[model samples]
Target chain A: MIQDIVTVFIKEFKEILQMRGTKRSGWINILVVIGVMGVYMPLMSGREWVTNLLNPISFAWLPFFLVIGVVADSFAGERERHTLETLLASRLPDASILLGKIAAGVVYSLGIGITSLLIGGVVANLGSLEEGFVYYPLDFLGILWALSLLLALLMASLGTLVSLRASSVRQASQTLSLSMLVFWVGIFLVTRFLPEEARVLLSGFFTPERLPMFVAMVVLGLVVADAVLISVAMLRFKRSRLILD
Target chain B: MNDVIVTQSLTRDFKTVRAVDHLTFQVPYGTVFGFLGPNGAGKTTTIRLLLGLLEPTGGTAHVLGFNSQSEGHRIREQTGALLEHPGLYERLSALDNLDFYGRVYHLPAIQRRSRIQELLEHLGLWERRHEPLAGWSRGMKQKVAIARALLHRPKLIFLDEPTAGLDPVAAVELRNDLAQLAEAEKVTVFLTTHNLSEAERLCGLVAIIRAGKLVAFGSPETLRSRRKNERVEIYGQGLEQSLLPWLDTHFGVRQAGLVNGHLELEWPGDRELSSLVRALVERGVGVEEVRRNKASLEEVFLDLVVDGDKEPYTA
Candidate 1:
């Protein structure tokens, strides 16, 4: 079983990275950050611009996975492409399929997470005029990275389930995008509540804050949730229904 | 005991639609079983059930002597499948994709490498091994799909229109490969397709499905023998429509339809085609040409779908 899952993961890994859309999105996102900070760097001497420049690592990771419309559509896209039926019929197990998809999404999502964090670091140091020239707080990077992985977990599984359930690629992606609304909203609520004193601490949750304890907690939570959702998705996968039509 | 796949009233329904209606069929080892149905006729659905990709809403299926729906994990280890319009990560190379799935089968890394090399070479994918799949042509991608299906050396393979999008040559190549695999590896194949000619050529036994229901199941020749009427094509410039009743009653044809002034008749058989020509000549109808259809798979499919519960073909 472990071998089956790893096989799928490795394959899905290469497949997703080379995805044209993801490659293009990575570059586009990089340029967008450069352009935004290009303006922020010169203006950082102003205090008003400082907070806006450094505040939300929340939305940073969000936009990267937005390309996961491709990821979200992975399963349905296979069916649309006529590959899902073949894949399910293959010697590869269904759990392996689900894991491969999640692995792909995680790896791809990680790219956006890291890139955004890198830019977040650059911008924080340059300081939008508001910082009067400041260095980006490393805490922001931590928060954004961790948040991205957490978000990737729930998001990828949800995408898999939706892809499995929908009849067409368009319908599957549309449904997946809707579920993302909840995640984005969660970001909104969490970011709004960040107190200045707690920014570094809360952001610790985002970054690899030595919260070895916190890390353990997150891992424990994810393992439990991942196992539950995986079994649920496995149970839900209806190969007959997918290929019948 | 040799049966590799079996279904007992296996059914799948979606809300109000019956996708596979009580489908019960099986294939013994060493046979190329063909499953025939029109598009949307539940052929693919049945394949999914056999593989345990989809759970049956009712009934049950056994694959490799295991309960397909519940013991799917075990069943997967021994089966290979090539479903319609199969997919792969466009970003990976042909070789990498195969190697990756090879791992899913848990082939040791050394063995996996050899296996990938073996299969890729066999599939003619060796030259394009390193190119990312995103850039491969449709045919190339399909070959990759085939390689993926056979990577594990599975005991039973389910090919649901495996040749669906291939060029004629590739389709033929795949069929030959499947045959070779069956003979040499002793693989049991459960194939489904809408292409009657392909089915006729490769399938040992054929099952016909219509509107999600099994309409006919038998050896290809058996079904062919069951075709009710001997259809003789008639070509002439002016065979008056007025001669129909006379032809039907005199020739013992139960019913007939005309296309472009050609008469299509369903009736009792004749020992000779010249006899139908003589009958036409007596009515002053020019019998331009007469030929026996020999009961094609298409005819069998049409009989099941369009005929509905209509009168059986007598001849």
Candidate 2:
């Protein structure tokens, strides 16, 4: 089973790399994102990028959004291009296919996220020549890695579920983007309209002394959501239903 | 011969429609079995059910002695299919497409490489294997898809309309290649096709379905011979106006007419050619040539479908 999943993962990752019609174009797209997030942002921010405590948290959400770009194509794109049925007909188990797709999305997003972070650290150091070499603290680096991976898994799970039901890749992408928009807007509205006492209590919970607890809660929530979404996706991944869809 | 596939009262329903209704048949080993039907006649659905991709609503199917629903993975592991569409990845190269499936089937590196090469070279696509399939014509893409299906050397292969939309030359080419491959590999083939001529040429046994029901099932020779309307054509001068009325009046003749320069007669089962020829010569129609004709598979298929429309469902 592990070998089968790895085979699917290899094919999916290769497809992701060749998604832009050519390897050169695909690499260029990846480079553009890396250039902006890794080089430009860190260069302009300089030492602040490393010293700022919130930098890791902000960067963790980067993979959350980045995974959405490619995960929408995970199943919907195969169905749209008439390849899903053949894949389903193969000997590979359903679990392998599902996990391979999720793995592809997670790996692509997390790889980019980590690479950008590393490049940002280097750029921060290079740009801060007068201040000498600088890097993110070890504890913060660990938080960045964990949060980025959890967030990527969260998005990958959500995106794959949507892609499975969507009639086309365009529909899947639009639905995912709209869902994210609605979620963020709803959170913003709820927070803004919260009672003053509740707002203060929430703010108190995020104090530096309690920051680790807050991150832990967030990670727990993502983990729970990922598990539930993945479970539902697996339940719905019947060959009969997918073929009809 | 061993029965590679056996389905008893197998059925499939989609919402309000019964796509395949109580389909029961057996496909023997090492033989080409044609599932012949018109559009929307449940051919594809039957293939899907037999392949274990879709579960039957009614009875059961056993492929290679394994229950389709319970042992679907085992069935798929040993069987290959080219479904309703070519199902090739257009963005990938032809070689990549076959190689991907080879890996999925877990062919070792050396065997996979050689199998891909053998299939592609045989199908005349080896030279263009590295080029992306997106730029190829539909025929070329279909060839690559066929190669992909055969790369694993499955014991049983389901091909859904392998030549559905090809032009004459390309269709014949694909048909020839498919025949050679199936024969050389000694594989049991469950082929679904609307083309009666193709079925006649390739299949040893055929089952025709209409409105999700099996209307007829037998070898091509048996189906063709089942229709009792034997035709006879007599070609010569003075065969049109003078013979038309006389031929029409005869009791053995079901219908008679001038086709091109020949006198054509549809003979009932009890009729004899000698009696017809003696009557034709006596009528002063010079009989230069006379030949007996059996119903073509197309005629039998149309007859069966028409007959099926008039009768209640019984398979």
Q: Which candidate leads the pack in lDDT?
A: 2
By TM-score, the best candidate is 2
Off by over 4 Å in 2: B252-254, B307-315
- lDDT by residue (B1-315, candidate 2, tens digit) is 489999899989988999999988888899899998889999988888887899888999999999998899999999998998899988788988888899999999999999999988999989998888899988888788888788899999989998988998999999999999999888999999988899999999989899898888889998777777787888886776666666666754547888888877788756667887787778777889888898888888887776665442223
Models 1 onward score TM values of 0.71, 0.96
List interface RMSDs for the candidates, in order. 3.0, 0.8
For each candidate, the DockQ is 0.44, 0.79
lDDT of 1 by residue, B1-315 (tens): 878888899898988999999877778887889998888999887877777778889999998899988888678778877776656767667887777677767788899888888878877888889877877777677778767777888887788887787788878887777677567666777889877888898888888887788888888878877876777677885677776787667765657768788887765654555676776787677777766677887787788877778543322
Chain A TM-scores, candidates in order: 0.63, 0.96
Per-model CA lDDT versus the true structure:
0.71, 0.87
Q: How displaced is residue A122 in candidate 2, in Å?
A: 0.3
RMSD (CA, Å), candidate 2 to true, equals: 2.0
Please estimate how well model 2 matches the true structure, expressed as its whole-model Cα lDDT. Answer: 0.87
Give the CA lDDT, 0 to 100, for residue A53 in model 1.
Answer: 43
Return the TM-score for candidate 2, rounded to 2 decimals. Answer: 0.96
